[model samples]
Target: MVTLDWTATEIALSLGISPVGCAEISGYKTWVNVANEGLADAVDVGRRQQPSLEAIRKLQPDLILTSRYRHASIARALGEIAPVHLIDDQENEDDMLASVYQSAHQAGAALSRSDDVARLLESFDGEIEKLRTGHAGQVEGRKLVVAQPLPGVPRLRAFAPNAAISGLLRKIGFADGSQMSAQPFGFATVDLEGLASLENDSTLFILGEAIPDDLLHASLWPMLPIVAQGNVRLTGIPSWPFGSTASLKHLARQIVTRFV
Candidate 1:
């Protein structure tokens, strides 16, 4: 099997299936960094948007998995090479966590690994429940703004209520405090002034790389109530906020250990 979607690659790896080929292997390693060992033997097909059809054909895969969002235009072309399975990237707009599970189930069915997927999801549920019960008293009901500082820019990409990370945080009892509304892609890019509407007591959970020095030392940085109260936290770990079940599990452990 070959996977052109990073999320599909993750789901395949979680099910103990190593794809014969994957797109953007290096980007996947840097961004969606979970289950990497599964990719060790896979051939790089090319970029997610424009995968090398010749390279994929060389793999002679029986099945090809890709995102509807990214590969809808090339679905027919991919089908010519092999049976193509389109995984909806936007399966459930209102509940991104549910979307992740749905995507996993879809991949499992295609790969005939439904049993493994079921076990994986069951374990994920138990782990989430344990974290929820254990940290409810300490973190429940706290408002959180999850944001990623754009590299070399002063803007932030804040996850909205419908984002996967926000939904996972909600399961662990924290409320989404981002002022942005539900967006199809899950986040909104905003300038620092846009964050002024957030509640004073809300915690700012900055994802990915550290905030650049320029932004941290901006004149308006310390004026925010959350900054003044020292409620800001850098994850200090690479995170793919839009990843699958394993990625969510990884992120949940990171949040609890680093901030709880």
Candidate 2:
């Protein structure tokens, strides 16, 4: 099997299937940051947008998995090399968790790992339940905003209610506090002033390896209620907000241990 989508790559790795080839391999390692060992021996097919057709043709995989959003234009081209399965990358529903489950199942079915996928999802549900029960007293219904401050910039990308990360947080009893409307890609770019509109009681979770000093010293920073009240949390852990069930489980554990 070969995968051109990072989410599909994650699902394949979680199911113990090492793909023969993948696109943007290093990007997946740096962003997704899960089950990377499975990709150790996999060949890099090339960029996600314009994969090296020659390289993929050489691999001659039995199955090829890619995102409908990214590969729809090249579906026919990819099909010539192997059976192509397009994975829906959009979270086009009210329930992002359900979207994750459905994507996992679709990938599992394509890989003939239906039973493994079922167990993976069941375990994910169990983990979520444990966290919900354990943290309900403190986190239940508490509004939270998740965002990543762009390095060296005043703007940050805030996750909307429909984002996978926000949905996972919801499962653990936190309510989305982002003031922005639901976006198709699950986040919106906003400046400090935009974030200041959030409710005072909302907890702000910042996702980044390191907070920029400029942001901390920005004139508007100290004035933000969430910052003034010490309700801001800096997640120094590197994370990929958009990922599969395995990545979500990994993030859930980190959230419970470090942020909760």
Q: Pick the candidate with the highest TM-score.
A: 1
- For candidate 1, which ten residues in a row score worst on lDDT? 251-260
Q: Which digits, one per residue and each the tens of the lDDT, describe model 2 over residues 185-216?
A: 88888788887898998887777666668678
lDDT of 1 by residue, 1-260 (tens): 99999998988888888999999999898888978888999999999889999999999999998788889899999999999998876778877778888888888889988898999999998999898999888778889888887877777888889988888888988887766778888888877787667789888888765776756878888887888888888887788888888887888777766655
For candidate 2, report its TM-score: 0.94
Please list the Cα RMSD from the true structure of every candidate, rounded to 1 decimal place: 1.3, 1.5
Regions of candidate 2 where Cα sits further than 4 Å from its true position? 91-93
| Candidate 2 whole-model C-alpha lDDT, 0 to 1 | 0.84
Flag regions of model 1 displaced more than 4 Å: none
Top of the candidates by lDDT: 1
Weakest ten-residue segment in model 2 by summed lDDT = 89-98
